[model samples]
Target: VPQDEQDIAGQWRTFVENNRLDAVVCIAAALRRGVLDEAEASRYQRPAVNLHQPWELSGLGQLHEAAQNADRLVCFGGD
Candidate 1:
């Protein structure tokens, strides 16, 4: 994430945690943008990872699962 988006991401993470929400980040997209969780970072030999708890880096299957379980699903797209 860029410096400007860090705060927003933190806020979203907090909101998800507080609301007991599930957040599944598309692993391919995140990796393409240099966003990785601890496991991914280690696997890719990255010194650090920008993603943390409450935000899961996963595949589309997880998204499908979330949609199946959720009352409503909202998706955001980016360049």
Candidate 2:
């Protein structure tokens, strides 16, 4: 990854230590920022949910298809 992108991912990783899934959006931010690649994403099999509104989400439904198929980071069943 580029230095600047790496820097951004590093900062976000710090936040992940603090907020975990809430900070990283079920690994979405990490994936987008290149902090977690496809292989890494496939490793997180736990369920996750964010109660915030649709507009409040960052990459809303980016993982919906995968979630439906029982992949890592389930992203459904919210108001």
Candidate 3:
């Protein structure tokens, strides 16, 4: 999904919840782009966190694990 689409209210939450899916945000990528979760926000003394529930900030290892365990995997990226 596009970066702008990410901040849209409740879309990701509802989709993930309804589908019983898990979403992980890459920690390094998120921090680099100023997309912080609650803990990160507090640690960095930021006033707010844009990333919320139904979406968790995690390392790429989690993504690898998820992919390894998934029945189907669809990845989108550009080198």
Best by lDDT: 3
How many clashing pairs per prediction, in order? 0, 0, 0
Query: Where is model 3 more than 4 Å wrong at Cα?
Result: 1-9, 77-79
lDDT digits (tens) for residues 1-79 of candidate 3? 5766665556767888999988888899999999999999999999998998878899989878988998988878978
Q: How does model 1 score by TM-score? A: 0.73
For residues 1-79, write the lDDT of model 1, one tens digit per residue: 6765568767887899899987878899999999999999999999998988888888988778878998997666756
In Å, residue 29's CA in model 1 sits off its true spot by 0.6
| Ordered list by lDDT, greatest first | 3, 1, 2
RMSD of each candidate relative to the true structure = 3.7, 13.3, 4.6
Candidate 1, backbone clash total: 0
Residue pairs with clashing backbones, model 2 = none
Q: Which runs of model 2 end up more than 4 angstroms from their true locations?
A: 1-6, 22-62, 65-79
For each candidate, give its TM-score against the true structure. Answer: 0.73, 0.24, 0.73
